[model samples]
Target chain A: MKPIIEITDLYFSYDNKNLAINNLNLIIYEKEWVAILGHNGSGKSTLAKLLIGLLEPLRGTIKVNDKILSQETVYDIRRETGIVFQNPDNQFVGSTVADDIAFGMENQQISREEMKKRIDKYIKKVRMEAYLQHEPHLLSGGQKQRVAIAGALAMDTKVLVFDEATSMLDPQGREDINTLIQELKNDGDKTIISITHDIKEAMLADRVVVMKEGTVVATGKPTEILKDETLMKDCGLDVPLTVKLSQELKKYNIINDIYVNQEDLVKSLWEYSLIK
Target chain B: MGIQFDKVNYLYARGTSQEKAALIDIDLNIDLNDFIAIIGHTGSGKSTLIQHMNAILQPTSGVVKILDKTIIGGRKNRDINIVRKRVGLVFQFPEYQLFEETVEKDIMFGPLNFGVTKEESAIKAREALKWVGLDQDLLQRSPLNLSGGQMRRVAIAGILAMEPDVLVLDEPIAGLDPQGQKEMMEMFYNLHVNQQKTIILVTHDMNYVAQYANRIIVLNEGRIGFDGNTWDLFANYELIKKYHLDLPDITKLIIDIENKLGIELDHKINTVENLAQALVQALGGANHVR
Candidate 1:
């Protein structure tokens, strides 16, 4: 399968003194939910910006969908990609939820009728249909992020980047967005890249890329990466609670398998207990 | 004495078409040296409740007594700065409030505002910087030039420099990386421990509430849903769910294990280590494991 997005030898710096992304190389395939996990200054967000042409790489190249990203092709690249940032208030440009969802479509000069159709479709996708007329300020942080996701989807972008989009939300809100992401992934075809420090969120992804100091430290399946305690610690991340509990129980010879979810872990424990 | 709120009711744009009640019949008593965690859904009056601690927002129909000062509703309180100085609030995303050119100047601003001497305020700023774990060299640099985490530390230090007896934090660790969040929580934990200061934290993370706070308060739709000890808060899962709150992961795991296995397990496990031990014991102890 062709890689949906290919980044090679990517180097970027905010100032000449510090390289925000240093000699990073990454490949994301079609319909893959890739989670980029790292600490605050680990260049994960910088990679997101570089992917959408918000920040230009000092060296190397980024290719999206077989086309090399350049100054001339940047707008086209952005049209194919949409990003939701950390703060919901900063990204909201419209007064109402419907207006916000329609803002991106209006920018593309989409017709009013077409815009209405996309807005209705995507707003329902994020489960914010009841809040179609609600203003941005009145909505909860999670609802605002849902509206932001709707706005992104209304653009019909194939590749969506969520840059710590759930960081500011409450636990319930985080769960809501995560469930929405799962639904989107189940629908398939779109490439999703989430840049976050949330271990549980990363555990749901198809691939987890751990970063450190602007470089890729490890990239593997979520289960594989999360099991490497030394690596997770080096990258300044906490292992998921279920994984940690499983490991601890394994030390006492109670549960042999490393489980990432609660139900499976409990089932394994029950089986072990019955055997004893 | 710390702070008390009696029948507090706060209305946004009161007596107008847009009037909305933010807090309804809030009666809370926060004792000195208390570590209290407030849990609620977004727009559940957490922010509005904490603002009353430092007189940032006065109640529409209540009496707020901070230390010895009494602020009555429907009356202008001219001496509220005394209450503000006694309760230092670290607002959410406080880094955005950093406006001073240098980090040191910004830290000193709060103490200086409260009538501390220039030299004393500088001393307090240095002490505050140390408390937040920032290096002394960064004091001269522009606060805007610092990293996001560092800027947050500086903002927190600005509040600490005020030497308030009570610290009210509104989601201070929001938007921080995992390591940053841990470090910030630890810093506050130390402050609560060593300084013996009252900590009133409004947060959405149940894990932090279970681990740190001795007392937990839940709010729902501008009303106090539940207020009790951390242990009771976790055990009251039904009430927790009703208020749109969740049990911490460790507690949830234990509950799940019990439900799946059709066996009763203790739900008092607050930490991962405790949960691991409890699971092993529930499976008939370590010796029984083949």
Candidate 2:
């Protein structure tokens, strides 16, 4: 797998005294969906901003598509990356849905005809074609997020970052965005990075990176990282319900395994119960 | 004493083309020391219903009774602030409302506005800070300088300073991380248990409903779709689906096992230990396991 984005010895601090991102090193491969999991003030969101050139790192380097990030190449780097913020209401720059989707492409110097075609195609892809003319403020939180995603994808960026994108939405809205993320993963073309504290959302990603206190604590497949209850606790996260149940069952010798997802755990328990 | 709502209906943008009903005919009685979880999807009238608890919004065609005070629809009501003082309603994202330069001043703001002396309000502020589990050293620091979780607690401390009998929280744990969410939930549960404070929490997360609350009220399109204990609500799968409600994770897992394995399992299991015990029994007791 070719590395799409690479970081080396990265360091950043909001104040001169405190290092928000402390000697962090990471590499995300092409077409990979990586979930950066952390508690509040753990510096996961700061890393997202650093990747998109929104914040300059105090030390080290970030390489995107084999090019290092710097003042000279910041614009070029930003053009290749797109990010969706936590609050949908604060991200809107256009009055209408269609206009919002076209705003990024317009900055890219795309022609009117091509911009219209891309907006039409991407808006429909997000299932918001009917809301082409609706003002963003009139839309629901979930709908506004979909429009924001459509805008990001319409720009044809190679990487997309969601910075706590679903945290503020209602449960149903959060589920809808998760479904969209699942669909995007199946397409297997864009590199996706989701910064969140939700274990359920992290379970859907191809890889999970757990951060604590401005550093990487663990990196592995979702099941490997999530099954370690001690590690999750150390990082200030409670394991998901299924994992908790699996651990309890293991304690009773009712089952000899730990299952991360609900389906697998339920199936294994059923099989175990059938033992005569 | 507690709050009572009678045939309450609320309309937004009244007398205009865009005028619409945000709440419909509703009747509810909240008793003293009740820990109620109000749940529904967005725009399900949960906020509108809670607003009536504090007289922030009056009913359009009904009545709201809080303790001995009564607010009749379309009629002039005096001393609305009295109801506000007793029933503290914490809005969603309340941290945004913190404006005082110091955390102490922010906590004292609510009490000071209600005619408490500065010295007395300062005492209340310190006590409320203890309830929120914040360090007293933060009293002199700016509210904006704190972390996100600390900011949220300081904001809640401000409400507690008012010495309200009934606490109404609108998605209090919405943007918090998992650990922060757990801490906030436990804090509220403690307030309900030790302080005997009435907690009316509006949330969409059903897991909290199953674990914390004794009573649950579900709103569907401005009407009471279901009002009962957690077990009964979860047993009615049809109502759960109709109102777009999610089952508690443990209950959902047990139901799935029952369906897929063709076995009988209790539907009332709410915690991991309870579910595991049920599964062990379903396998013909503890002797079945090696």
Each candidate's fnat? 0.73, 0.69
- The 10 consecutive residues of candidate 2 chain B with the worst lDDT sum are B281-290
* Candidate number achieving the greatest lDDT relative to the actual structure: 2
Clashing pairs in 2: none
Q: Model 1: what TM-score? A: 0.97
Mark the regions of model 1 whose C-alpha exceeds 4 Å error after superposition. Answer: B287-289
B180-199 per-residue lDDT for model 2 (tens digits)? 99999999999999988999
| Candidate 1 local Cα displacement, residue A39, angstroms | 0.9
- Each candidate's interface RMSD (Å, one decimal) is 1.7, 1.6
Model 1 scores a C-alpha lDDT of 0.89
Residues B30-51, model 1: lDDT tens digits: 8999899998878788998999
